[model samples]
Target: MSLIELHTRSLELAAELIDTVQPEQLVLPTPCADWSLRRLMEHVVGQHRGFAAAARGAGPDRALWRDAPVGADPGGAFRGSAAELTAAFTAAAGTPGRSRLWLPEIRDGGPFPLDLAVGFHLLDTLVHAWDVAAALGPSSAAGIAAAVEAEPPLAGALLAVAEVVPAAPADRGPGRAFAPGRAPATAAGSFGRALALLGRDPDWAPPAR
Candidate 1:
């Protein structure tokens, strides 16, 4: 599948997980330490908008990257952002040189290629969808399935652009996007292996209330 297709699938999976979030679960802790579900949603929305702006040739403006406000209607807010992101990506497809993306923190350097930017975001969406599922606990069967379904396509897309993605450094520091988590056992399926590669424990569940 194309990067755009993978991104679309990832967004759909993310939306599925977001839709399952109970109001009370907003404050729950996720695999991403220090970020509650609510905060994580905000971050997701922010990233969607930021990437949309980048695809539009408007550099990754810091203002566009600002965390979205997770109001009482978090799901609605996220859906809106996701829709905008999809539209922007669709419009930018096949027009690589038309715009430049500003990604200062890129492992290789600044100013990322259009395809690389899109692929990186696709990878992030897939992993974060799983993060949401893990936070929601085992009862979210539908969410879990959606996340699992997204893994292969997104991971394949990432591999297509792996050269741009920075390897996880030895130090699992706060700023790092992924830590070097323990490798998944061979028995772990594609989804589980993808999560493990992204530094997430596939079996992670929320603490009992």
Candidate 2:
């Protein structure tokens, strides 16, 4: 599918996941170490908002988008933020799509194309959504399949990043394994495995399972 479709799908999955967050789970710890479930939701929503601002040709400072504790229930906050993000993204994608962005990840004080920005958003939401699901427990994996399908660049980027960066000690976390310094290899198996290779695990299976 095209990047827009993929992004839309990711957003849809995000909406579904967000609606399920219970108040108690917000403070739960996740695979991301320091980020609690509430913090993770904040990160996810805030990032989407940042991306939306970017889609509108808004250049945002990193601090402006930093994660914070969720005041309301995470699910409700997520729904509001996701809607805002979707609107902004839609507005940006509606025109000729020639906006430039300042994404540090791509190392461009970018004047990047709109499609590229949306693709980046898709990749990010996919993993972070799964991160939240992991904290919530087992009923979360269904969204991973949709998220994995949304971003082709994630898989490709992982392979390329691995080829360039030397692998670290094997026990390092999944995220570290695909960092720029490691020359790792592409993983085998499903899209989930591919995501794992890139340092995002779709299987974030329950700790007990």
Best by lDDT: 1
lDDT of 2 by residue, 1-209 (tens): 55666667667776777778778777777867666777778777677667766776766466646664557677667667777877877776676743556554344347667766776676676656767777777567555554454555544432333333234565345544232232223544344554454565544553553
Candidate 1 global lDDT: 0.71
* Residue-wise C-alpha lDDT for candidate 1, range 87-186, written one tens digit per residue: 8877877575744577543443347766777777877786777777778875663356444545666655644443334454744547777766558768
Judge candidate 1 at residue 124 and give its lDDT.
Answer: 75
lDDT agreement with native, every candidate: 0.71, 0.61
For model 1 the TM-score comes to 0.84
Cα-based TM-score, every candidate: 0.84, 0.71
CA lDDT for candidate 2 = 0.61
The alpha-carbon lDDT assigned to residue 134 of candidate 1 equals 71
Least lDDT summed over 10 consecutive residues: which range in candidate 2?
A: 176-185
**Could you tell me how far off, in angstroms, the CA of residue 196 lies in candidate 1 after the best superposition?**
1.3
